[model samples]
Target: MNNHIPILVEMQKLDDVIAEKLVLTESLPKRLSGLKKDVEDADNQVSETKTRLEENRKDQKLKELEIKSNNDQITKYKNQLLAAQSNKEYKALNSEVAHLESQNSLIDDVILQLMEDESSIKAQLEEELKIQANAKAELKANEDSLNLEIKEVEKEIKKFRDQRNNLAKDLPRALVKRYAALIKNRNRKAVVFNNGNKCGGCGYVLRPQVMIELQKGDEIINCENCGRMLVFHE
Candidate 1:
């Protein structure tokens, strides 16, 4: 009802938009971090798969070297069997050869299994690489746009805040101070519309006399419960 109410209402509108933009400013970086974390997670998956593949390859190499060494020892044993002078010596050499051949067979099976594991690891590596690529692309796609939106939101909030501050200059200092305190402490709602006989901000019951005074628009009337400046609404 006070003359300053209209100006205060206008300032509230600006402040509402500033508040909205400010929220966007806060959320944008969090969203960017989330997006970046996706890329990091995918990259880690790829790296882990590659490390497994590398380990598989190294194990295969070491196993192959073991087989080669066993084969060399078998050849030496065969030559010794040819030169053996006694029956016992020849039989011992023959036994050694057979044992070595059996060992080679087991080693071959191990090598085959290693090869199979290598194949599986390589396949997994390829899939992980693809996932990593897709995650990076997705981050690149969204990052720039989100950053731009964040900047734009910041600029808009600053602009709206400037307008609201300028408007405040035209109002009485004591009233502006009161409104600012309410806005800071009451979820940015220094002024609220009436919902029937209740305060819109806190649902506090408003008496008939207060409602009548609000309708009369003679002066500012704060809600008894919430202390917010009330605007009469249908």
Candidate 2:
């Protein structure tokens, strides 16, 4: 029974490694998801900026057409002023030309403002596009690295599992069954060291007789309260 303690300790070491590997496996996908989201957000910013620039260009075109139409109206009004038969008609034609010129002046100011805004927006869009490209490249590299790491971790877990199985084969069948049952019912810790006179698994105080048996290491001694295999390491 005392000889079996070393095998159980070895099994516990393998179980600890398996548990850590499992946690790492679960975290890899979450890391990949986070990187994907970063790239998506950068792409969205670039798309929205391009849409705004296109709309601004359309508005500038419309303003230029309006200015051209106003100029044509002014030319026609000047021709009517020359053919006027009365002073009143002449004044009316001149006023119409003035009104059209005034409207065109305002339109010109608006066009200039639109041009400035377009220039600024174009620069911003170029910068955003560059950032988006970099983000995509970074995501791809990280994804490849993470995939490789996941494979390595899986291989290590397999190795540890094989080692534990081989060790279990050396122990008696009944003892293995008992150890398995304890692991299932006791938080995966089938064997524990005594902490002074207390059970290390459940912190239960051992009776004087149980403590004496554990110290001798002659037979398997379970904690009376928690039923976990107790080992006394000198």
- Pairs clashing within candidate 1: 1-217
How much is 78 displaced in model 1, in angstroms?
0.5
Each prediction's number of clashing residue pairs: 1, 0
Q: Which residue pairs clash within candidate 2?
A: none
lDDT of each: 0.89, 0.89
Candidate 2 — what's its lDDT? 0.89
113-229 per-residue lDDT for model 1 (tens digits): 989998998888888888888888988999999999998988888888899999999999999999999989988988888999999899999999999998887888899999998
Error of 2 at 75 (Å): 2.2
Off by more than 4 A, model 2: 2-4, 169-191, 194-213, 216-230
lDDT tens digits, residue span 1-234, model 2: 578889998997887778789889999977888889878998899899989999999999999999899889889989888899999999999999999899999998999999999999999999888888888988888999998899999999999989988999999999999988987788778888999889988999989898889898889899888898889855
TM-score of every model? 0.94, 0.76
Error of 2 at 41 (Å): 1.7
Span of ten consecutive residues with least summed lDDT in model 2: 11-20
Q: Candidate 1 — worst ten consecutive residues by lDDT sum?
A: 14-23
